[model samples]
Target: MIRTSLPLKKSLKPKRCRSCGANFNPISSMSKACSVPCAMALNDAAKAKSAARAAKDERKSLAERKAKLKTRREWIAEAQAAVNKVARLRDLLAGHGCISCGARPQQKFGGTFDAGHYRSVGSAPHMRYYLPAIRGQCVRCNRDLGGSAVNFRKGLVERIGINRVEEIESMQWTAKWSVEYLERLKKVMNKKARRLEKRIEAKSEVNQLEAVE
Candidate 1:
């Protein structure tokens, strides 16, 4: 049970000064430089090399981030979302439920709805952000049947005048959106949507109180 431990093995190679190339027996296994001055010089050089490498990596990372930055497309998408939200709420409040099906929100099985476009975005990319072109519709009519184009056209004409519908249909100009414009539009649309939501909530409260009375 009582056993004596053997001494730890030491490296056979003598320590060499990394800074001056002088060889000597090392005090410890980790001792690389022979003299204090050699060790200090080696440390300073290593620190400088590490700093240079770190600076290079930081520059590379910043350049890559700039290269992969979001463009006008992302801004447009966000602005469109806010616009659609406001349009859907507007239609709901106006009692123009499901422009394609004439199905009221209360009549629908689910509460889900969408701001459907009269002119499909794929067909008219220029009118994607056009507020008048978008109207509220049931999920079934919009997503499942691809907007029911026939009914949508009729409803659109009735909702907005025939002249306006013709104008939008004849529009050939493509508008190039800027990020600044899109950002501003997004804020405006969001504020309008929030105000509409408050009105809808207040109206509901009034109707509920009347029903109870």
Candidate 2:
């Protein structure tokens, strides 16, 4: 049988020698080097260059993967920080003294305050971020006196009401936090923190002005 198809045209452009800069016409379009030695050299050099690029790319990809993993852990930590910040702000804004002690910051001996948890995060992880479960307390009362159990109950009842306090005590479910949920919670808590900071600042200025008068 005879093939009757027209012949294919070759590339007209002169190709540069892969091993040297000399220009030459390729015997066929697929030909890379002008001579045998140049072809072997070119092949080796091409292989080495390709290997180097692959290694560099692998290193870059590895670093990026590690960074992505780190983000989830960082978001979780940020969420916790934001929650604590908001809780502390809430206590301060309410003009309440320490939940474990009746002493105000100025009136207290050490004058340090912390957002103390009523149920404790270890026992009630579900209520870890519950606003009503936390209240302001002097450092001594919170840490030294073991959350000052006696006064803590009294303060919790007064601040959040008896019913709400009872509800928190009755809570028994575990709260599951995902990376995505924590990221969203961080944003919300951060916004609340900013607003609370502004309010606190404004109130401080007003108090200063009044004292001066």
lDDT of each: 0.86, 0.82
Model 2 TM-score is 0.62
**How many collisions per candidate?**
0, 0
Which sections of candidate 2 miss by over 4 Å?
Answer: 1-67, 71-74, 106-111
Candidate 1 clash pair list: none
- Give the TM-score of each candidate: 0.63, 0.62
Per-residue CA lDDT of model 2 for 1-213, tens digit only, reads: 997998898666889987787899888878788899999998899899999999999999997687467666587667877887798788787787888777787634544887788988777778877777878788889888888877899888887799987887898886888877887798899999999999998998999999999
The ten-residue window of minimal lDDT in model 2 covers: 102-111
List model 1 lDDT by residue over 116-171, tens digit each.
98898889988888888899988889999999988888888888888998998898
Q: Best TM-score goes to which candidate? A: 1
Q: After the best TM-score superposition of candidate 1, give how far the Cα of residue 147 lies from its true spot, in angstroms.
A: 1.4
Prediction 2 global C-alpha lDDT: 0.82
